[model samples]
Target: MTDKSRKPVRKAVFPVAGLGTRFLPATKAVPKEMLPIVDRPLIQYAVDEAREAGIEQMIFVTGRGKSAIEDHFDISFELEATMRERGKDMSALDGTRLAPGHCAYVRQQEPMGLGHAVWCARDIVGDEPFAVLLPDELMWGKTGCLKQMVDAYQEVGGNFISVLEVPRDEVSSYGVIDPGKADGALTEVVGLVEKPKMEDAPSNKIVSGRYILQPEVMRTLENQGKGAGGEIQLTDAMARMIGTQPFHAVTFEGRRFDCGSKTGFVEATLALALEREDMAAQVRQIAARLLRG
Candidate 1:
């Protein structure tokens, strides 16, 4: 799967149009992507991952009430002025701005599906190969998941999806990959099955919501084929491109927290807080104290 003739992945498309129904009232006014794992929002982690992967432009497929996401990446004049007056260090806000042209927002008008959300950004993505990062899936590591995928994409130059081995029983909640051959972290993806029953799953390696896809996938999504819950599933579109192009998966070499769920969110909060030197000791004490009750 070594084809280096493909275009460099410069832009990243973030599908953020979902209603975030899983989070309920917390997400009623706020976009799920805005929910903070610690001090940083989920979308910030995703944007940072894309930036680390050398992605130049960010295409956010957003919906109504998603303006906070746009605001998150934009420069706030008042806040900066206040920080300046208060003699606060501005270094913390250094990576917040994406420049003007670096960020583009497209509206996904309806609650379609991941495929439709991605397709909504087609015009912005153009003909070049691009990356996709699902913000809710917080992938933490020394080298970000998208960066790892980009490195693999450079060698393989087809389509790469970040994967991680979950338990077989948990496969029903995710898109499982039918593996062909494995070479270290990279595996030849023979097929993709979206949310298969546990007994029918091909492998426990579930798609981890980070992707480096060729532009051709946009064409497949344009057809709007429905599968697995009668929605235009992205896995179905990627599955069609399986043999036609090189499709592979990188078993992510990092911790992933599914921030969309309450338990996963709490786990991520604690885990990430424990990573910070400033918060680790206090957080550990708080956890120990709570457990003693």
Candidate 2:
């Protein structure tokens, strides 16, 4: 059961220390999180979602060559001044800027894994429950996914993980959940299996990138040993918390694009571009032409 007096979740952690080896040369100097989807970078979408979910502090776990990500969120006075001089609308940047003192950064010195990256923010998160968002997963919906999870967390309240059903064949790509009881969109998670093969998988409902975890999960991660891929896996730590707390899975009521992969990135770019009133017609025409050839 949730502690009625526990403080509300006001902070969010973003782990972005990975080297985008798949994108190669393009990501040589530019961090993959800085890649643009239409006009906004991937990281902006996650930050915007966190803000919408009432997250007050944005904590970033970064590494070498990731300075670009930090600068993107910082004030660019020169550019803003030039835009004002040119009589351009600056409203587009309104959501992107973080208020002074509302942001913090921690260094992930090694390329350990997602679990370690999240652990790096242990001090900032302190004793409060916090949200974790992976920028590579772009979720589109009328309401942000984290906000939906937060709403669910308010009711059930231990650890809330955003989940989505994937094909059985693709179960190996994610951490599969063993559901216990169903209650509309929320399911009681009995067990979790990280990247299990099709035959070993428990269910098709896989854990997505959004999480609402109690501070105790940080304690679990403190001595978490390496699991799959020989690295400390967040899934491993989360699995240990299932029975000890009120663990539940909230299915996302939206489309999710895995922007970390090349194909998913292109699909997300096209999907978002086609949604824009200004670019829809032209993008449709171009898509039609490409499909015909």
Candidate 3:
């Protein structure tokens, strides 16, 4: 789809209310989304992706002990003053902070599920279609994954989700979608099964933490019961909206790192560091040595 055809996705909701139980000790004090992928924090990458997709109103659905996540996006007067005094080139820090009224934060009282966290932002999202991004899923591409999905949303006009193929053996770990017809980069979702058994999986397509959902989804989620893990599964709610509204999965050409996992977090750092000009030589040598061993 052409750039002009891309409908402006003005608002986006970031669900940061999860208790990072997987990364225990580190997560005890610091929110997992605040953890650095390489240089930038995980949540920053998500915000960058949303901005790339033309999102204007950024809403963060957070829980307790997540002040750092909010502070990261706020202007640090002392830090900025110090950088200016030292004549440091801090342009990279420019877009990190949000201006007054441009951002909003709401608390998800309980760690219910992705759907519940998203539901918390319903009033902010209002009646328009809004984008949902899970910060833990870090995607790398020339154009952000959400940008691609936004492009597809413009053409399809219902709901667009970013999808990728995961191993069948790993199907039970993710929300898998049954893909129907293939239309260019878009795939029609026939069904959505929340982490089905390996043999029961309809297809290999997994929802990769990015979505462009319609306002109607809020109603479905409002009355939706708990699904997988006794949590209000967002996939389940979105699945109900299927056929009633058009749902398409945009297969992005990119690398996705599940930074929610310890292994995935390290992998993302290694991959990004290996690609950087300053770190490439050292990173390559270490990788080569490790391979030799």
What C-alpha lDDT, on a 0 to 100 scale, does residue 121 get in candidate 2?
A: 99
RMSD of each: 1.5, 1.2, 2.7
Off by over 4 Å in 1: 1-5
Q: What C-alpha lDDT do the candidate models reach, one value each?
A: 0.91, 0.92, 0.89
- TM-score against native, each model: 0.96, 0.97, 0.94
Ranking 2 against 3 by lDDT, winner: 2
Candidate 1 C-alpha lDDT tens digits along 102-185: 999999998778888999999999988999898889999999999998998887789999999998889998889999999999
Q: Write the per-residue lDDT of candidate 3 for residues 148-227, one digit (tens) a residue.
A: 99888877678888999877899998888898999888999988887789999999888899999888899999999998
Which pairs clash inside model 2?
none
Residue 83 error for model 1, in Å? 0.8
| Cα-lDDT of candidate 1 | 0.91
**In terms of lDDT, which candidate is strongest?**
2
Report how far residue 68 has shifted in candidate 1, in Å. Answer: 1.0
